[model samples]
Target: MYPKVGSPKKVTMKWLDKAFAPLKDYLDAHHPENAKAIMGWMTYKGNFDDLYCYENRMTQGYIEFDRSGQLIRCSDNALDHEYELGYERIPVKTESIHPNVDRWIDRTVSAKKADIFREELRLFLQHVWGPMANYDFSDLKANYPLQGSGSPYCLYVYPSRFSKMIAFQFVGDEIVEKNCSLREYQKFEKSEREFMYQGWHLVTLIREFLAFEPDLSTTREVVRKGCEWADMRIDENTEFVLTAEARRMLEELEKEESKK
Candidate 1:
């Protein structure tokens, strides 16, 4: 026979008094309007570890409001602090170095991964050349035909805006090479060789122009796609070279997708 199961018991405000009195007193003294609006309370139990495990900890508390409303505040009992209800803005002064660019450059320099660095450069070029080179967006066309012969590079052309074509030579959806050379559909070559050579790494090319560009929608999309493609190729033995911040951003993108 199955063991007897008890019906759930509803918790009342009186029960909450033992635990939330300090929080109540705080709100009563400071934000009385918020205090008066409280209708019910809830608690969360979880485990926390710091070198060792601590179980059955009351990790959080919440207050609910009436009129089909709620104002929730979670407490970190261990830290003795409440989470902020609203957002705060902290101003940072603009710097010459882009965070991603700096991190990528540092990693590349330290790892000495010249081939991976070059591949990243080609990917960056495929994305930002249109905007950085000031191509007319309205005249731009997606997935232009292949242009070159011996190397056979695919072109993402923006004709009538300029004579130069940004050639992205690919190897099975992965961009293997890129260049700004004139094609049969174009007239003159735009000299972007200095942009490529002056930089110690691929990030310098991006930091020079793309970072300051007003319209970076295309660049953002292309970079995200490139990263996704790279992620698919990663295995246990593969050393993923993206910086911590970049990995965090990618994780956030994954979280957003999961929510959807």
Candidate 2:
């Protein structure tokens, strides 16, 4: 499905070596078999890729590559590993043809910041939702705030499941918002809650902190002690007040009843 490998060109061993450097390092460390098995595909007569794409997910090659140089043609289901069956496996390029005019930024992350995204988010959630709360973030999706599509985790309470205490269907016109350090009853109508933009604002702050430093001091007052996601709704036309203290009392009462 790539543009017919329309205009293929050759790339140097140096360029190829540079482009795949990170993968080479990883494969060198971990994947000895795949490191040896991977092959370079070329168009007929020693030409490298002209245009490219990869994955049915279609996440890469979204925009046009440099139209003037070496590229790869990526077909649908390229992950299936069948594209090379009929293509020519040419020898590696020996000469540099065109100068890489644009500035090439290295995409490698420093070892200190590597692979800490999910862990940092987990810490943030635990600080807000309490140590006992259970959450499922397997479907969690996030984007840079105010820039891209915005993270889905910041849009809805469902796709990324918080425990039942914080995530549930609104059944009535009003719910008591409790344990958020309010001196009096805090009521939020369903319509008002819909517009609260609760998740959006929360995610924006988290994103800003992540992009700069991991310091979460700005959010210290908002989400501590299960307040961020805890809102008890009215039940059977009656207001339910289940603050953290009330839940603790209920637990003690249950234990006493069990003993009796």
Candidate 3:
């Protein structure tokens, strides 16, 4: 079994707490209109060891929105099981520069296995988050295609005057127009139809852009698809999808982050 790192160092907790202190203080001081949303996440209940374990299993890097609405980044610990995955329950000693050389061969083997797992996980995360992890959204202009009457295929043409660009598709000369919005196109309602609605999907995409603050290409792609999906018009009889334009953009967004 790997050696334990003992109790967490006070300094580490201090730094961690300090990381969220300001945001927590902000919510306590001047409450914003979304104060409820922000305040609800102020306290985190998970153990770091367990948290790291889950993160490792998911192969996700330790970047998450903390309870205080602050961002915490877990650096890639390729050699440590817990660090690599984001959980802390591994039997191996973590944060220890010195390992028991008495069992050098076994420790070395365990470390190697751990390293392989970490590499696989890192690759998975890179594929999932994509170029948006590296790019910013301010660089791209909206270019949603105009869906003419009755056509199934849609495209992005330009930014909208209001929150989103509106596009139309047609079937049998019947014109179907969809209006798009950048944010909050319509107030959120609690119906399954409304929740699963394309408009909500667009809003989610916008939130993703703002949350990650990805690169220009990534941002533009997100905004473009968002606009395209927002413009799609669906009816009781209309075959509805998330939209190819939107899916393509999302695919690019989920491409490998590392150029290599």
Backbone clashes for every candidate come to: 0, 3, 29
Give me the candidate number with maximum TM-score.
2
lDDT of 2 by residue, 1-260 (tens): 22233221333455444434433444366556655443222111111344332222222212122224223343433222123324333322213211111110012222332232333343334443222333333433232222333221222222233332233221111111111111111222332344344432232233333222224443444444334555433235555669999999999999999999
After the best TM-score superposition of candidate 2, give how far the Cα of residue 121 lies from its true spot, in angstroms: 2.5
Tell me the RMSD of model 3 versus the true structure: 25.4
Off by over 4 Å in 2: 1-120, 132-193, 197-205, 208-214, 225-231, 236-260
lDDT by residue (1-260, candidate 1, tens digit) is 11111112322444334224444554576667655443122221211121111111233333322212222333344323334635433322233333443343344322433333444333343345433544324433323223323212222222223233223322211122111121311221211232133321111123222323332344455544443442122334556589999999999999999999
Worst 10 residues of 1 by lDDT: 46-55
Ranking by lDDT: 1, 2, 3
lDDT of 3 by residue, 124-167 (tens): 12322224334222222222232222122221112233343332
Q: Local error of candidate 2 at 58, Å?
A: 34
Considering TM-score, which of the candidate structures 1 and 2 is the better prediction for this target?
2
